[model samples]
Target: MAYKTEHITQQIRAAREAKNMSQRELSARSGLTQSHISQIERGTMEPGLSSLVDVARALDLEIVLAPKKLMPAIGNILGSASVTSDTLTSEQRKLVGRLERWLAGVRDQFSIASEADTLKDSLALLRHLPLSADELDRLREATLHLNRWQDDPPSRKELSEFAHAVRQLRNATVHRDRDGAVPRSAYALEEEDDDA
Candidate 1:
């Protein structure tokens, strides 16, 4: 089956609301156009992987993809059990803690992984997050922003700007290259400057 864009979009929208964010705030955070966010939330657009990451970052959420079976097993045995947030059983809390740790590891690993591998791993990880329809909408918007980045590589100055925008959405530290910067290729810059 094709990837479920609508489902994911909905989740983004929901998450944003849960965090009490407005569309404009989300747009500013994710570097996405407000209109595009609206379209995705309305189920009129499907976003790519990079956008999803941006949205997830904006919401202080992380994405992970493990085997589908493994997630349900963990959720059922841990999250859905008699384990309220305030009253987590030792085992239940431990499982959630492990998942969080694993997710952190995955994020760290992505810094060194090939871009293609990073994208794939990100998509998989995203599937494991407790996404709702609204959060998915925000994710779609963020994905659109990333698409723009891929289409046109920014200049070093532009990349610095882009990175700053990403930092806003991510609300967390991002890994930089060995030089403490994310590089933008010339071709990528050309692409970004060209008007579609």
Candidate 2:
């Protein structure tokens, strides 16, 4: 029971952070006291069903019961869907991994480390932003260039230039995706059959 509460709290905290929401904001949205939310998130208080539902709904989530035996299948489906929906492609992931390995090998170099850090930070931002197909293609092209450089350590100047380009890409994405992405609702409303 303690483990379940911890897991639930962790999930709720992670979701709230991912949405860039503060605890007070969530409290306001959920109609719960900030201290109550804090206690719940810390696992110091066990939330009642109604409070849990309120918090979940405020986080754009809902609780659902699934057969224990079907958990693995559900996990697999959701995992694949997440990968498909994300902006990163397999090739881009490979390139990023390759770059990270290279960066790790030369972490002692101050100039290279600074530029590498910038590139890495920009990449993280780029991954989170909702991108159009054309913007995604642009990202693919950038990753392809980065892939070609994977075998060679770029000079500080070159790395800085690449980092700048990635930041520009991230900025453009943010400007274009002003509204952010809307998540799919968990429940669907059914229309009543008037003829019946």
Candidate 3:
């Protein structure tokens, strides 16, 4: 939690370089001067929390504080653990983690999840789902339209169709996951072997 400014600077520099962005571009996007950005990257300037936040936002990175033991490392750090011995299988746990991360990436903290948000979120969520090329393209086109219509609300029919398509995608995803899941009999056989 108490990282040296040098470590922070290294992370910032790495993120910028990984994106192949110049310091000037980072400065422009983050609203910091190029000299200041360079100084931060060189570890000559210590950035405040807010400035680091701006840089992080510009680079699409987040700074998370977790306990060293890392219990919060699993699932949502602030939310209830979705994994339980009696409920979620390991596969289900993994899928849930992926979905949560996708949703988190779709929206910043404290943002509302509108219908448009849901469609955008589905694009990332469907990576884990078994979707045909046409289905994927349809979702992508719909999401693009929703994103473009932020200034102008989409038509009633368009919204209805997009929502229905998202529902269909989600239903297909659940069924695909279910079909791919190991049958309970497989677990029962394993239990019997353990007893034997």
Candidate 4:
């Protein structure tokens, strides 16, 4: 594979993993088989434009065409990009902060357990998962539950249960395979004849 192809595939792979999405999940969303995704990520097969667009859309990414002269400006903008759609919303970030504070207060009262660590891990994942209104409400409810315990901290077992509940909530928000008509390809791979 050429360096450019390798670089592009690496970006796709990194983006997929950063979103905590498996290639199988991406395959379902992109309407490509898992093997196809694997090959693309490995740079063994050159990706068609339609295939690349599908994969990028599945990852909530947009592909734009720009003049070559603007490459430096575009690169600079991307390099300094912040809080893209893939990241948690501001409200979600605030809730996570509150949860962290609650956790800190709980730790002061009781010896931290593995469940606390689990809760932390779950919170970390919340940052990466796509935020929807319903998910936000669920997260808010979790924060409310934590706040309730702040005044009267729950027992170790109760805390463990709470951690499990949060983990389940996060898992519920994670994307799953869906059945539907996949998006049509935007381009055809076969070369067109100039004299038709």
* CA lDDT of every candidate: 0.50, 0.65, 0.57, 0.71
Model 1 misplaced regions, further than 4 Å:
1-3, 77-196
Tell how far residue 124 is off in model 4, in angstroms: 0.7
Model 3, 80-182: lDDT tens per residue?
2222243334444344454344434434432234654665555444444444444455555545653466667555565656555766665454333233342
Residue 161 of model 1 has an lDDT of 41
lDDT of 2 by residue, 1-196 (tens): 3745677778888889989999999999999999999999888888888888899999998888886544433443344334444555655565456555655665555375666677777666554444556666776676666557668766767667766777776655544312334222222233242221
lDDT of 4 by residue, 123-146 (tens): 876765555577789888888886
Global CA lDDT computed for model 1 = 0.50
TM-score of each: 0.40, 0.43, 0.38, 0.47
RMSD of 4: 16.9
Please give the TM-score that candidate 4 achieves against the real structure. Answer: 0.47
The 10-residue segment with the lowest total lDDT in model 2: 187-196
What is candidate 2's CA lDDT for residue 132?
56
User: 142 in model 4: Cα distance from truth in Å?
Assistant: 0.8
Q: Give the TM-score of candidate 2.
A: 0.43
- In angstroms, give how far residue 118 of model 1 lies from its true place: 25
At residue 116, what lDDT does model 2 achieve? 67
